[model samples]
Target: MDALSRAGPRARRAAAAPGPGPSPLPWGRFAAWIDCVCVVTFDLELGQAMELVYPHDFRLTEKEKTSICYLSFPDSYSGGLGDTQFSFRLRQSGGPRTSPFQDDGRYNREAPLTLQREAAHYFGYVYFRQVKDSSMRRGYFQKSLVLVSRLPYVNLFQSLLQLIAPEYFDKLEPCLEAVCNEIDQWPPPVPGQTLNLPVMGVVIQVRIPSRVDKPGSSPVKQFNQENLLPAPLVLPSVHELDLFRCFQPVLIHIQMLWELMLLGEPMVVMAPSPTVSSEMVLALTSVLAPLRYCCDFRPYFTIHDSEFKEYTTRTQAPPNIVVGVTNPFFIKTLQHWPHILRVGELRMSGDLPKQVKVKKLAKLKTLDTKPGIYTSYKTFLHKDKSLIKRLLKGIQRKRPSEVQSALLRRHLLELTQSFIIPLEHYIASLMPLQRAITPWKNPPQIRPFCQEDFMKTLEHAGPQLTCVLKGDWLGLYRRFFKSPNFDGWFRQRHREMTHKLEALHLEAICEADIVAWMKDKSEVEIVDLVLKLREKLVRARCQHVPVREETLQRVGLYIDTIIGSLPEDLQAVLHHP
Candidate 1:
């Protein structure tokens, strides 16, 4: 099949941009959410393969194609098979130096520069379908329909796929064309605003929360009370931050999981399907939200992934990453990983799924173990059984899914914030007093973090103080200091504090009477001071040290004024630039 040459110009143009920029197609709108639509089929000769990329002419590097193929289909996908849906991420190596989506005016356009520098990843939503086919060699036809996007709106994408995939599987290319055309009509994602996305005759209303908005504050559109509609308007439950759905079965061990996430411990999640594996991984990564996870994570990993060897190697300690896989091979391959959570298929038992009990295994027994958490790390904090009980009771009372999800979200958010509060307070104390600053000398360095001293303060100000949940937070903090997560958090806080001090120093220098200082020095000395000030300004701008705009302009005016008063040769040398 000539897959590459089948698409027309519009399809090619829509999927062209790798990151976030305007599509060349004459659709006078930003490339909304869907980046590209792909159809991956299992080929008898080539194994997992891409049957067609909707934008057939859109070029994918061989490496990219390999990644898409493996991630789209589950490995060791045998036994009882039905349709399954999951998500994956792909890290692109390069993009525009500046924010590419600035013109798009989306709230999430400003991606973190540091994370972007490391590797800017995008999301892939895959719907895998298998059907009995006697004509096929494998006795089944297995394929996946994928939608790529820079945004991580899992629910919206999944909903889109529900409408598109089944039709596309039956009708083929023509269905994809109709879907893409429908997507073209979608309004650009505005932060904190409800979006009514109409796709294939269905209006899916959703709110994409802004980073500034508190978690779970996203409002749902309301239907008029006077209109006695035959059917009730029900908003889809948001799963983007749905930690409850993933952890409900294993809620008793969530404290330990939170600690592991905080320490950036390497873990492997084994599940029965790609959907469960991906959801669990995504949920675990967000266990310590508000404080970035600062480590690598893959939702649905496969044996054929590029980093498969890097992740599975037993030569040394495992890298800080959370790998989710369905293939039984990982059970043995990732046995050496510090923590492993093996979960069974998600069961619908009303309020919660069947609680997956934590088994304190003498050894991982990687060769054989039931579906449960297998980890040696003892949890420092006590489990808040009251919270779980309340949730269960609410479920028993038949609370709506939205209500249950909100309750879970609030509990977790508070839990995370309570843990982080003491750290924030202590870090604030480390900053140097403003009175200690001197115009003639350098800014004072921040006091180093003392673990023992900070631990002592926890008695009064720890998470237990403000939060209903109680724990041996002191022990958690002591262990935390030795973790990569603490180091990353400390370094980030330290750098930000250091930047503030430097900005203060620059302001002090700018405010000093440079004109008077020049009076006391020889011509050469005056020239040297002028040059140093200029260099400092350039350095501050380049480093993004957050100096005030007015301060920068004032320094520039001073430099020009000082240089004008210098000897003609000195003035010419300074003005040459």
Candidate 2:
């Protein structure tokens, strides 16, 4: 049966468009947080199908519908009957990818290019369940409740699904409507602040750490939370996204993984289930903390994905993107990928979780090889035996998993910082002297960053000189320079430096006597000067440049006063807005 026809009347009514009359409460305001709620189920004939999507008008393309269905039901059922939850990310099919600062020529279009570029993707949190029954076809019933959103609140969204999905499977229509209404009341996801989001009577407390803050540090505040069940003081981590838990199994080979991630190498993670597969892929992207991972990645990839043909073709080299897959079929299909990490299922039989063994393979095997990290890539940094010994000792003592995760996370964070600190020092040195900058001509261009020159600095000042962990630092830097992450980092710094120069020039102009400068000039020249100053003001407001608001305000007053003194026709042209 077609999905809509199979849905009950209540389901249809809840999702239907508003009838022609008084307009319904605006949903577009909340669209930034939650896009739509959807119900997907397995079809006897059509395979995975989208049965219902709330706000029926929030449409999905055919390709999107198929992808969502496949991702929502990540694993094919054999005879199981249990509920599983996970999250995945996909390219946003519909939405404005424009900058949040976009307005009617008020903000500079080129200021927030990174934010606009990154807005092209969105996230999905899924709660899937299955039950066995002789009365149903195939002896089972299976379905999934999914929340499609742009924010990456893994802990918050998964908790929301846990509260709603079970009730949804039991009561159906009422549960869907209730959840949709609750979501409609949620506030916009403003970063850098703690937000108490209520869904289906549960207040989920979380904070999406701001990029402006220091990595790994987000302040916590007590809230008078009320719910059917007591909520956590704060989610264990709304910032880290449970990255440490995902990397726990493969903790031993983390340095090797970090190297590969930094170099933006094409790797495939093969896991026993979609939950593990997706988490592993997402965690890999954040290994180079504080520096963004610019390469593309798919948390859960299947043979049915739209890019399957492009990702699997042997005719060309694999794209520089991380691909996570659950099917053994990918073992043979993606065998040509440079790096492959095969993760084993969770082993809960022991008091303490045993670290999975890692083995490097000479040839890629379709089914015979065991679970381990399989790659020929050599690691430049030496393994930290001291840290490994402590971890192993903690395992021997049967330390709690939470303690183990924290220990690992701290070590990785320090390792990344050690690598980044030296670069920051060198980049700071490249900045030109403030005295050399003049108000007359454009500020002199900053010196170009050099790889060899940077390498030469290692003898006197490098990560190894300060950090306890040692490595062939030169070798690592060489590989890093060739990666997409390096390109992104360099470009961001270049933009910052360029903006700094512009800001200095602006400050100089603001301090000068603008009225005296334009005293002898014609009306046309005065109008041109005002326009240039206004453009600079807009750019300063839009970009994260070092410029005081007082300077900008003074420049604005100068423009207004200068325009007031002009002839009537010219003044009207200046004040057209």
Best by TM-score: 2
lDDT of 2 by residue, 1-577 (tens): 9887698653443455342221134554346466778899888898889999876777677778888999898655445569988777787666654422223331123322222223667678899898886877877788999888765556777877888899999999777876675665555455555667666666777664554656555366445555425574356555355655687677677788888888899999988788888888878977777667788888888888888999999999898899888888888888878789888875543644445665565556858666777777889998888877777678778777678666776777788788878888788789888887765456788888988888888888888765787778889999899889889888978888888888888888777777677679887777777787788888888775678888888878888888988999888988995
**Candidate 2: global Cα-lDDT?**
0.74
Candidate 2 lDDT trough over 10 residues, lowest sum: 106-115
What candidate 1 gets wrong by more than 4 Å, as runs, is 1-36, 54-59, 79-82, 90-120, 133-140, 174-208, 215-241, 347-353, 362-368, 435-442, 502-514, 536-548
Residue 518, model 2: lDDT of: 69
Cα deviation in Å at residue 67, candidate 1?
2.3
lDDT of each: 0.74, 0.74
The sequence of per-residue lDDT tens digits that candidate 1 reaches over residues 190-267 is: 665566656666666666555555554645554443442333323453235466667777876777888899888898
Instruction: State in Å the error of residue 209, model 2.
Output: 1.1
Give the lDDT of residue 228 in candidate 2.
Answer: 24
